[model samples]
Target: MDIDDFGPKEPTCRMLEANDKRAYFIVRDWNLETANSLRRVMLAEVPTLAIDTVEVIDNTSVLADEFIAHRLGLTPLIAEDVDKLVDFRDCDCEDSRCDNCSVTLRLKAKCTGNDVMKVYARDLVIESMPPSDKLGQPVITDADGLGSCIVKLRKGQAIDMRCIAKKGIAKEHAKWAPSAAIGFEYDPANKLHHLDLWYEGDDPKKEWPADEVRIDLDGGPEKTDEPFNYDAVPERFFFDVETVGGLSPDAIVNNGIKVLQQKLASVIKELTGVDEANAGLDGAQSPAMDGGFGNDGYGNDGGYTTPGYGGGNAYAGGTTPYGATPYGGAPGW
Candidate 1:
């Protein structure tokens, strides 16, 4: 057996840790690989400081399709598909528990919500033991007013949630602070029902990979007196899932900014060994850690105070800017 398939790279490292946390994050071109990494980071009970939830809560409830497409990293072919919204009630499959109408996304963060309005998903990863739950069993992130609640549950649990709007990384990553947040207690005796958001789509790529077997040179179909027997066909065929666009152009642009910013922050950290807080991204100027503050407080003046909102007075007043007077007060005041 080749054990090298499971080694400690970024993905593997993420799968083994425990009790981690996050503040703010910005990543781009997020695909299943990154999403899988994130799943591990959440299950390992990692900590997150910012107000963002590990789960992407679908609040609009209208853009269920968009949220699923974002999580799956599926770029829609048609622009209108971006807004091809659907709700949980769109399904006519008798029971409302099937995927003919919904898609499920479950994530957990074992941390506190003390920071209310200051959470982000940057540099955050979670790990777990059995990975994800079988179909129909999903961790729902919806609970109370907790936009970023932390729950204690084993594998195969359900999570329902809603996340905050982020203006991307450029304007500072937004935290997942719901109108309210939840704090869960470990209820051992109580059995929780697994909740899943079902959707209508069948694609092999979305399904887990099947197990592979190698037949020996002389191997043939072994006759069995057993009640059941499995057959094998070495032929291969491929099928494509129906493609549809998701998210509006504005939303794509906005989300893209956040992703790029997160990517930039990660790269900068790798090259300079600097944390996001001190990297001059979140309002503060990057400092010249060489013992003295440089020209703009950063080495080679690399950091500059972000343009405006430093003192909560909006941009510096030169001439009446937009909806304000140059001096003080409201536009006309």
Candidate 2:
């Protein structure tokens, strides 16, 4: 079947509300399955930089080293430069860490002389910064102007640790999720035009717009003749998304689309047995074919056949109840 028979090649999007942290939009001419796929990608596939490993150098505080590491991993880091960052597993470096694949963050806190102290995300020192203007400091701050508080310490207590941040998707962990919420729903306004408002309410005039109310109650419940048409449009969906300050709402959506495209490209390459690196080469041959019956290059035919039950049908002697024929065998063979 032709590919176009599946669905529209391109879907349309319309933005209704947009801001730094939140966005609401509409997608037209797309099925519910497509809309849901976009939402899933936004929530779980968009990549972001997050603290993945921690090395504790010293700790005499109330919190254990593992607890501290857990808190550090949850602290959202500045991930706007994720596109420029490489995954540690995919990097060429043979060691456990490298500049291109990971960034180091250090935190040190001490409390002394009868005073209680608090350690926050701002205290985590980023050893290096990416060469991008869009990214700021790595720590995330709350609306109260306080960074993500790691722990509290009593007098004479101290803590010191180093963390490694890496680029990853939310599917690995919640710390890497770029968006807080992503969802879509059918627009209800599309169904409003089909309702008969006249007979549904006490005072029909008060229940709907003047143009929608058609009964002339003052003239004895008679209906005024008017031409009208329902305005319901099919396959329209409204989407709402919220970002987690690691990236903008728009960036999360754009990245989700990019990730989806890459996944589709990979699937197509696998199914077509095409080596993308050599696809553009001069006179590069296609992969060896697996015939309809999946035969090896040798002459042995590989297809379903009834062994003792079939003959004279397509195979050579007597006819059988089951229709079993050799691969590519003629009827008289």
lDDT winner:
2
Question: What is the Cα root-mean-square deviation between model 2 and the actual structure?
Answer: 13.2
Assess candidate 1 and give its lDDT.
0.27
Sequence-dependent TM-score of model 2: 0.66
lDDT of each: 0.27, 0.68
lDDT of candidate 2 over 123-159, digit per residue (tens): 8887755545434245454676668789999998898
Q: Any runs in candidate 1 off by more than 4 Å, and if so which?
A: 1-245, 277-333
Which pairs in model 2 have colliding backbones? 311-318, 312-317
Per-residue lDDT of candidate 1, residues 1-333 (tens digit): 343343332221111111112112222223344444333222221211121222454322233534433432211111122112222246465643233332333332322333322212211222221112221122122344222223332333333343211111112221211101111111111112122324456753245332222111113223355443234221211111111112222223223333344455568555433353243344221122333332243333322234232442322232334235333453756
Give the count of colliding residue pairs in each prediction.
48, 2
